[model samples]
Each structure stands twice: as structure tokens, then as C-alpha cells.
Target: MRKKLLHIICLASMILLFSCSGDVTDELPALTRAQLSINLLNNGDVDQQEEINSIRFIVFGSTPGGVRLDVNEHILLSTPETATDIDAQLLKVTSSNDILVVVIANEPQSLTSKLDGIASHWTLQDMLYDISDILNSDGQIISTTGMPMIGVVRGISIAPDETQKVEMVIERAVARVDVFLEAIDGGAVTGYTAGSTSVTLHNLSHDSYFVMGNVGNGTRDNADSSKNYGKVKENVPEIDLLTDTWTAATSDTWAYSSATGAKNRRLLCSFYTAERIFKSDYSDRLAVSMAYVPKGPSDVTGITEKVIETITKVDDKGSPTAQPFTEIRRNNVYQITARVGKIGIQILTVTVEDWGDRQDIDLDMDL
Candidate 1:
């Protein structure tokens, strides 16, 4: 599934110097004042309430020779709006020097304040691109403020009398995982029904950078095994029970037939995590541990115990293998599909998707 992203368009209008009678005059210096209008367009379906909570614009000015100047400042444009698309206007006097605009959205108040306190350009860049503490007090992936996003439009030549339209694209700072489970009757395992299932994700990173770069301050890398990940978590648990009504149904699984004659699988769990890489030996790679209990009356006797399985990767024939799932990246979605039967659980497919692109990793395992 694709995540909804926000598209931002900036319109900058700079006015020319005018005489007392409102006529053009060469006697006065050119006016450097500008009025900027930013229209934030929701790119996909209806907006989620917490998708955008606040927006901050930072404008940095430097000399033509790329010499860093002290003319750098940031402004909070406005609180988030409920409309499908939002427009914010900013009027300010800026120099004619080349400017770089950095727009950030949905950052928490504490992080925003900390960003505002930094005075040095290089220091601010370091803090903005890489930081920790992404989790909340409840240990959730992101705070109530929402998913943080950042966009940069640099090397903008701010002329005295010109109108410019700049379009910026913002991206999510975290990755999402969606897990699906289905029970089918086609394989060697039969007469067993779907049951109460629990999906546990392993080796998740807690800290993530605001922007993408090679020098990661949090996640572990495949090349280096000893470096510490920013508080790497193992066996993060998520459990969902099968209701009595669904378990007693005629179908063997929690899937329902669609109008197109396709079975819609049940979503076991979903979550967000920071980026991370597996070790060279694939010892610390990401994985999922699943537990399934047979629900209702089962055809097979003496099956009261639940089955537990850990899946990292599998071969073409649905058996565990040593192939590594190398890395998890930001602004991406990973979907894992598995089938449960009398024998045990079999991972069917794993797919990684970005906003527009998708790739499939076909690895199967029987537990």
C-alpha cells in the first residue's frame, strides 16, 4: 500500500520600487521585500488528522561566493489546517543574496525549539539531518505531533523584482511494516483452521535521521557488525486474537471472498520503525516471530499447544534459508504475507515498496 504524501508549492512575489505618485522611479533603491504564499497539496486520499500539525520555514542567505552569512532565520508559518489543501502567506524583507529555503513539517515542539536554538549553519545542518529520540514516552514510533517531514529548495536567486514558483517534495522520516496472515486448504496441512495469531517483529531501530544520508548516527550497517544501533529493539510484540464468531465460521481462515472471486487476507499487524541493516553474517538481520493457536474445534486431536516460528528468509520451497534481508530504508513500506496450516506456518512472500516503486522478494518457509 502507498502512503499519503504532502506536496508543497511555494510562490514568491517580490515588488519593485515605486514613486510617491505610484509611478516607476529609478531614483530610489530597488525594494527587496517579498510576499510568499505556500500551498500545501495533499497528494493522495483525504488527509489524516495527525498528518500535518505544524509547519516551519527556514530561509538561509549567503553571498554569491558561497560565503556563509549571518542572515539566517526561521518562521512558523501557521498551525495546520483541516482543509484538503492549505495555503499560508508570509511577508518579510530579505536581502537580494542567494537564499536557501528549508521547510519542515509536523516536528514536535521540543525538537523544533532545539532546532531554533542553534545559531551556526553547520551545527544546524548536523542537528537537522541526524538526531535521535524519535520515540515518545509511551514508546510509540512517533509522537502525537505526527510523522516529521522535511523539504529543501536551495540556490534560489531572490531578485528585487521577480516572481518565482518553487515546488518542494516532502518525505516521511520513518519506515512502515504491514503483515498479513492467511490460512489455506491447498497444501499438505489440512483439517486445521485459522487461529489466534501473534506477530512479533525483531531487530528494529529506535532512532532515525530527519533526512537521508550515508553517515547514519543511529542504525547499524551491514559492513560493521560491532557498532551499536541507537537502542536496537528485539522481539517487539504485537498480538491479535481471533474472535469466537470468526473462528466458528465455515472458512478455514480469516479471509473473505471478494466480488472479484479473490480472497482478501486478514491484516495481522502494522507498525513503524527506523532504518537498519543486517550484519555481514546476517546474524542481526530483521525478522518476524509468529505464534498461532488453533481456534475452535480442530479436526486434528492433541493439538492444544500453540506453534511458534521465527522467519528471517526462506528458500524457493518454503523452508528457512540463510539469505539476508539486507536493509530497511525510510519512506518505504514492507509487506509480509504468510500462510498457516496444520504442519505449521509458511511465509509466502515479502514485498518492499516505496511511494512509486516496488520490488518483491519471494522467500518461503515452513514452520
Candidate 2:
């Protein structure tokens, strides 16, 4: 009888223990779901809007254990549909700590597969891209594929069953350069027109990372051929204007003729380049090559000249200065204003400003 009573007590103890275990399990938090509404702030410009062909949205969460991902989605815009805003459902959100949200726009199709490897383990800086894939053979961002852009939101608290509306500003990963030729006092040289001028960007890297940083030199594909400028005109002497004899700048392109006598500072050409930041040294920095005709007196035969001048910095008056210009940030516009002065003297102004804001950095080339 005593053994029977002891067995009954043992069974009772087992029942109570399981009941306590169930209570403890119930006290722990359960994974929940939330919703996210992403509103991409954009200008209504059609050209800018066309750059956004698709978008990839990702959410990452961290805990004492390890990293976790609640969402990974890529959406392609339909015909004539510019995705200015988006809505996504968040799954398996822990809500214990803040989460990180990343959005990338107009990435290559191959990136879709690469992103899968990063879903479980990733960092913001680990997201790198080869610049060649983003640029065309002419070293310009491909309009059909669209320009690359990114936006990140961190420390976002997503409560369970609550919809969070977030506003993000996405910026391009490339820089745009607009060239303007303005005819200043033609100096002693007569018939010197701003026409027959060509600009070339030199010392550019063939490959760079799309990710923004203080320095862009990282692992490159090494096969890229965009190291120099694009569509350079033939018969343009590569010799230095300061040291070599003068040659006339000539091009069959109609734009060359239209640039002449641009006293009103008409747009010459627009091109794009990868981002760059040079803190102290400017050797690896991008440089501009301006080739134009330096007109002499009409009566003087064989006095007309063409020369290529390379400039690295600009002064307050927009002339190339000895001081080094440091950086070329992404999504910024470098407006070059070339002012023709006396023969062999040209002043150039390089105005650096955000794409959204217009500023002047005039480059006056007085030749």
C-alpha cells in the first residue's frame, strides 16, 4: 500500500512539472507580423523618374543569438509605372529590438540571385557593386537599365500588427557633368568663337564600387575599359597646349558648330561619371581636357591654333587653380563654364552642387 501511494505521488509530481513548463513557454514572446509602407520622395522630373526601373527591399533584425531577415522582395515596375511608393508585408518580426531596412533601385538582374546569399547574414557595407555593370560602354549610366540608387533606414521599431509608414530619399550612385561654353572677351584674337570645342574626362577608373565611401578604390573587375573619356573626336592633338605647338580643334559632330558664339552660355554636352573622393592628393582624381581653337588676327595666316588643356582645380573666377579640388560625390552635378580669354589663356569654372540644387563653378579658359 505504501508503494502504491508513492507511485501516485510521483505521477502527480510529473503532471505539475509539465504544467509549469507550459506556463514558462507561454510567457515567452511569439514571432509576429507587421506591415511597412515605403514612400520614396522623388522629384516629378520625367528623366529622373525613368531611372527607377525596379526596386529591392530588405529588412534585417538582430538578436543576441544571430541576425535574422524578415523580408526580401524585388518588384519590377509595369509599363509607364514609376514606383514612387511601395507597400510590403513584414513576416516573422521579433519586435524585440529595432530593425534595419534597405532599398536599392535599378540593380542588375543578376543581383537578385546574389541577394539570396545575404538574406541570413549581411551588413550594410557588404552591399557592393561593380561600376562597369552600372555604366554603359561610353562610361555613362545606361538609361534603359536606369541609374543605380540606394536608401537605408535603420533603428526602425516595427510593432506587431502595426503598420509603419516610412519616408525615404533615394539618391543616385553616379555624378552628372554639364558643360557650358561661354565666350568672354575674345582678347586680341579676332574671329575666335567658342565653336569647335570638345571636352574629355581623363584619368578615370575603369572599375569602381557603387557603394559610397571616403575612398572608391576597392576590388574591381579589372576587365573594364572605361578608364578614359568617351566618343573623343579624331584629329584632336593629345599634346599639351602649354608646351606643344597649337593645332586647330575640329569635329564632324554638329554639336561642335552649335557651341560657337555661345555668349549666352548654352549647354554643350552632358556626361556622367562614377563617384570619387580624394582627401589630400589629387593625382588619382578626375581631370578635364578642353580642346578648342585659339583664334589669332584674321590677317595672320596659319596663326589659328587648337590646343588641349587639362585642368584639375578651379578658382573663384572659375579659372583652373593650383589648389586641388577634393571630391566628386554621387548624385551631384559639376557644371563646367568655359570662358575664352586671350589666345593661350582660358579660364574654367567648376561649380559642384547637389543635383537637386543648382550652383555655379565656372571654368573660364582664356586662350
Candidate 3:
């Protein structure tokens, strides 16, 4: 009995397939979304409100050799006049193998609001493409070329007052590919230290390009040589007769100086903003040194023009140094010494704008 029923169904299908007189066939796929016309009833009426009454769809004939053909169908509707429609309608579809038939219906009584708002209306073709995975559940394969291929269509229109109908057809398949970001070579860096001595910073990132240094000193004095009036030879001022001095004048030098081989004494530093130092392409090692000072204030003002008219002194020719001491090179470290004067010892201090961890440096000198 089961075999007999299967035979009967097969005969009926064959008859249906050959019954068509014209080119149109039941086997042919439906039209694409772009080809159909979708209209909303009473489109601009405030009171009635627009909606979809029913949908009308048509399927076209297939190409030779069972190849699918491309068809255009219409998909959505909008108010059209209010604003230039910049909104784009997108539909995503997937299939196990190939789609065969697709059916769509309104979500039971789900209707659009009367007020102005974004509304999406899907046509028969649009619905089919959106659910291609379900249609092709059986894994039935169909020739895509020349035969109807799946695709989506979009349109803009206003809401109608009464129930509306959307018509569409399915056709040629549309393919979309995905895109992303790739990295390139980092950037260039020219480093420099403020005063002298090459400073090395670990884990330096690409962003740390500028460097600076700060150096300073301090001093203290404790000596009394007065009222002796040259009475004793031991109390006589050894260096200068007019100035009072202690017997240990030659033995103890009052000059203030940085401790020998002190790393903090001659600072080597570099600077960079937080943003640049943390960049992805920064290097772990940094070698920076000070470069010559460019056109400074003195260069702009024509001061210290030329002592001798014929020959131009290279060092002091164009401009005198702006600051008391300008950093000549990074490799050269300054050994600052403070001499004791009549009053007392003097302290020296230095600060650089963009340097490493330390902001400023201070040194004590015995004057």
C-alpha cells in the first residue's frame, strides 16, 4: 500500500510538471524583492494609520539547464516626503544547502503604530531570503546560475492609513564579504638628553622622543677667625691676609662639589607624555643624548654681532648663549664646583622640563 501511494504521488508530480503550456513552471523560483511594488493604504493619513492588508507574490520561469535567474523585488515602505531616507534595510540569511520554497505571514495581529516612527515591512521574497535555512532543510540542491537566486530588496515610503499589501519577487544571489584592521611599522624617534651623559631608560616605548636633565647644588660653612689681630702665627690667614682664616685653611678645602661617581650628581634624563610612552610599538631599550641648541632668543636679536668686523667667531658669533650654561652634548657630564666666598658657601639647583622619574636635582657645595 505504501508503494502504491508513492507511485501515485510520483505520477501526479510528473503530470503537474508537464501540464504547463507556456514557459512558466511550478518548479521555477519566486521573484526577487526588488521587482515588486509595496504600497501602504492611506499612507499619510493621521487618523486611519497605515498597515499591511495582504501580500501578492509572483514566481518567474527558470533559465535553461535548470540554472537560476536573477529577479528584482521590493521590500519596505516609508512616508517618502518627510526626510531624505538615509536608513538602510539589511537582511541576513543562511541555508544548509539550497532553498526551495518560502512562506511568510504577519505576526498574528502585529500592526504598526499611527505615530511617526521607523517601521520595517518584509515582502514575500524578503521573508524567503531571510529564512533560506528553513526552506533548504531537506538539502535539495538547485542550479544557481540563470535560475532564481536569493537576494534582498529595500525601499522607502510613508505609512498608510488603511491596510496595505507588499509585493515582491526573489532572484539572483547577492554575496557579502567581511573586513578588519592590520598593523604597520611603528614611527621614527630622534632622542636627546638635556645636559650631558647618555641616559639609558628600560622598556622605552615609541612615544618617548624628548629628554631633559636638572642639576643643582647646596653648601654650608662653619669657620670663625676674628679678634686675633694677627697676634698668633697659627691664626694668620694663609690664603689672604685681609680675610680671617683658621689654621686648617690649607688643610681643609671649603669648596663644595658633587660626590665622586654619584649617579644622582650628574643626572641623565629623558621625557615623554603618558600617551606616547605606552604605545604598542615602543621599544624596551632607550639611548638618548642632548643635541645642539637650535635658533635661540639671542639668534633672533642681533646682539653680540661681531667683535672683529672681518672674522666671525663661531662660538659667540651668531648669538651668545641664552642660559648661563647650555647643554653642549649628552655624552659630556658637567663637574660643577662651588668656591667658598667671604659670606658662605652657595647651593646650586637644576631642573629639566621632560625627563625621567626625577623632576629636579640639588647639590650641596662647601664654600
Return the top candidate by lDDT.
Answer: 1
Compared with the true structure, the alpha-carbon lDDT of candidate 2 equals 0.46
- lDDT digits (tens) for residues 1-367 of candidate 2: 0000000000000000111124454433445534354545445554444335777766777666766786778777763235444333233234636566566678765466777556552343445555567666555566566666655555555544454554544556666666555444533342223444445655443233443321112112224432211111112122311111112233321112234563335455655655555434344544555554333443221112222133344445656444445555666776766544343434356677664544444334343
Higher-ranked by lDDT: 1 or 3:
1
Q: Which stretches of candidate 2 lie over 4 Å from their true place?
A: 1-29, 45-48, 83-96, 120-124, 161-163, 186-197, 211-263, 294-324, 342-345, 358-367
lDDT at residue 344 of model 3 (Cα atoms): 27
lDDT of each: 0.49, 0.46, 0.19
Regions of model 1 farther than 4 Å from truth: 1-31, 47-50, 64-83, 91-98, 128-143, 185-196, 212-263, 293-324, 341-343, 356-367
Per residue, candidate 1 scores C-alpha lDDT tens digits across 1-367 of 2234333323333323222234535323443556555556554445432356667666656655553533334444356453244556464435555555556666756577666665544454545322235544433445446666655545566665566776655556677777666555543232223454445666555554453321122122335533221222223232211111112123344423334755545655565666555455554555666544332244332222222123245444656554456666765688877665555556667766654344455555544
Candidate 3, residue 146: Cα displacement in angstroms equals 34
On TM-score, the leading prediction is 1
For residues 59-79, could you state the per-residue lDDT of candidate 3 as single tens digits? 222233341322222333332
Give residue 269's error in model 2 in angstroms. Answer: 2.7
Per-prediction CA RMSD (Å): 9.1, 18.2, 37.3
CA lDDT for candidate 3: 0.19
